[model samples]
Target: MKAALVGADGALLYEVRRATGRERGPDAVVEGILGFAAELRAYGAEHFGESALAAGVAVPGIVDAENGIAVYAANLGWRDVPMRALLAERLGGVPVALGHDVRTGGLAEGRLGAGRGADRFMFIPLGTGIAGAIGIGGTIEAGAHGYAGEIGHVVVRPDGPECGCRQRGCLETLASAAAVSRAWAAASGDPEADAADCAKAVESGDPEAVRVWLDAVDALAAGLVTALTLLDPRTLIIGGGLAEAGETLFTPLRAAVEERVTFQKLPEIVPAALGDTAGCLGAGLLAWDLVAPADGPAAVTGSGAP
Candidate 1:
């Protein structure tokens, strides 16, 4: 678990990281989050000389933001957890904002990072699993039931490998960081090989590595094309572990997207600027929203939330 207290200017005032001790179950994880928040609060009071008016938290899984509940999180083994209320109580009645991690990252990207100024954008993270955040007009659209941008589950190869979600050929099965590594390992007959090794081999012109890389890229492109056609977003911001490939990923992805588009305006594809800090920054934004009264459309930059 990780926690950070961010100032209204988006500066990290205090931070903490600790193991979730999650083997004990959901209660432990919830306790860890609350404990971390308490530590952050103490640090802020001592060092920053201020108390936060509100708190924002981002958690993995299906978060019902409107209801302030974490509906489900397979990794955390939590279901219907009232995270916002818990945090509010721990913090002594401060307002709290809760959101999904991916959506929060997307919110940061849309407001202040790569997708800034884009009316419509998609933030796709190609890490252990494929997931996305759709932003329209500076606000992320969480969809009905708060599960809108689960692009990873979109089947790209209908007859391909089975996925943890009990489906076959989901995009995550082929194009995610873990999937790419697994595919490369299988192809090379080396159980220890990972995606980074595979990328290195591809860079050295290894035929098998190139093949695996191309296949993963193709699957990703297929999924992205669907998103582009459906949303007509003005930009697509790629982040997470796989995007570490930089131009090697973007060059091919741009070409593939261009090939798939017939007459639509192709969106500019770019790397995320905030790196891993996006979620925390976005959480801060949410907290700012809770405390700072909104006069109109929230302006970008150091102007707080409103």
Candidate 2:
């Protein structure tokens, strides 16, 4: 788990990273989160002469924000964890906001980064797994079950490799960074290969690397075309590790997206500004939004518009 003390001015006052200790069970992870928040609060009291009005926590998997329940996290082996209530009690009854990590990152990008001013936008993070956050009118549209933005699992190739979710040919199988690396390694007989090595090979014009890269891009473009047709988002912001390739990914991606569209207005494709910190900053924004006075606008710094 990662923790940060974000000031009212939007500056990160303190930040730390620690393991969730998943081997020890959900309760242990919850305790760690609570202890970390307490440490941040104590640090604030000593250095800033104030306490955090509220806290925001972002977690993976299906989250029911309205009910403050972490519905499921396959990675953490948790089901129905009452995160908000647990954190509220631990933080002396302060309000606690809970959100899905991808959605929160999307919210941050929409409000403060690449998607600013876009009425409709999508944030797709190409990490170990691929997922998306959809934003409309500055509000994230979490589906009724808080699974609205799970675009990664959309089937793109019917006969593709098996996925962790017990599915085959999902977009995640073909397009995610992990999938790219795995595919390259399998094709080249390099057990130790990873996505970075694949990208490097592609840059060097290796035939196997070119095939793997093009196939991944094609799969991603196919899924994105579906997203564009369904949501008509004005922008699509790409982040996570694969995004670091810059034009190496975007140039081909943009062309593919355009090719698939016949009449729809093409969305602007761009990179995320906040990078990996987007989730943390987005969590802070959500907490601040929850506690700020409803009658007036809260102060915003950096790039976000009120």
Candidate 3:
């Protein structure tokens, strides 16, 4: 879990990381987050001479942001957890904000990172699974049902591997980091081969790795084209594990997207600038939003003294 004490101008006054201890069960994971947050609040009071005005947490899975509930997260084994209320109560009734992880990260990216000036942007992270965050104006849209930018589930291949969303040919089934890892492991005859290794092999001009990489790129481009056709974002930010390949992913991705575009204005594609801390910084923004002027900028920089 990532936690922080953020200043009104979005400075990360303090930060810490710890294991979620999921093996101890979902309940324990919640307890861990609560305990970690309490510690952060206490530390902020001691070091900065005041308790945090508000707190924000970015979590994975389906979140009912309006109600502050973590509705479901398959990986974390969470369901219907009233995260905001719990955190608020734990931290002596301070206001608490709960956000979807990808959306929260996209908020940081849009307001302070790669998509800073884009009025409309999309943030897609190619991790174990693929998900997206839609940024419009200054806020991330939660959609009518809080499932707005789920581009990964878009079907790009009619006959492909199944996805955890119970759909075959889903974009993530063919294009996510997990999918590339699986393909590379099979092609290289190395069960432990991962997407990072696949990227190295691609750099080395390995035919199998090239094939696997291109296939994933193709699927991703197809899904992205579909999304762009509808959203018409000004910038498309690619992030997560697969994006660590740098140009290996972007060069071909750009080409594939260009080949497919017709009437849609192609958005400038860029790597996520904030890296892994986007989520934490975004959470800080959320907290700041509760206290700062609605028209004010996040004005945050992680370079502050710890």
Candidate lDDT scores, in order, read 0.86, 0.86, 0.90
Q: Which ten residues in a row have the lowest lDDT in candidate 1?
A: 295-304
User: How much is 215 displaced in model 2, in angstroms?
Assistant: 0.2
* Residue-level lDDT tens digits of model 2 in 143-180: 98789988899999989999888899999999999999
The clash tally of candidate 2 reads 0
Which residue runs of candidate 1 sit more than 4 Å off their true CA positions?
Answer: 293-306
- The root-mean-square deviation over C-alpha atoms between each candidate and the true structure, in angstroms, is 2.2, 2.8, 2.2
Off by over 4 Å in 2: 293-306
Which TM-score value belongs to model 2?
0.94
TM-score, candidate number 1: 0.94
lDDT per residue as tens, model 1, 1-306: 666777666666666677888899889999989988877877777776777767899999889999899999999999999999999999999899998999998988888799988889999998899999999987899997788889999999999999999999999999999999999999999999998888888888899998999899999998998888889999999999888888778888889878888867788999998888888888877887777734111532354321
Candidate 1 lDDT score relative to the true structure? 0.86
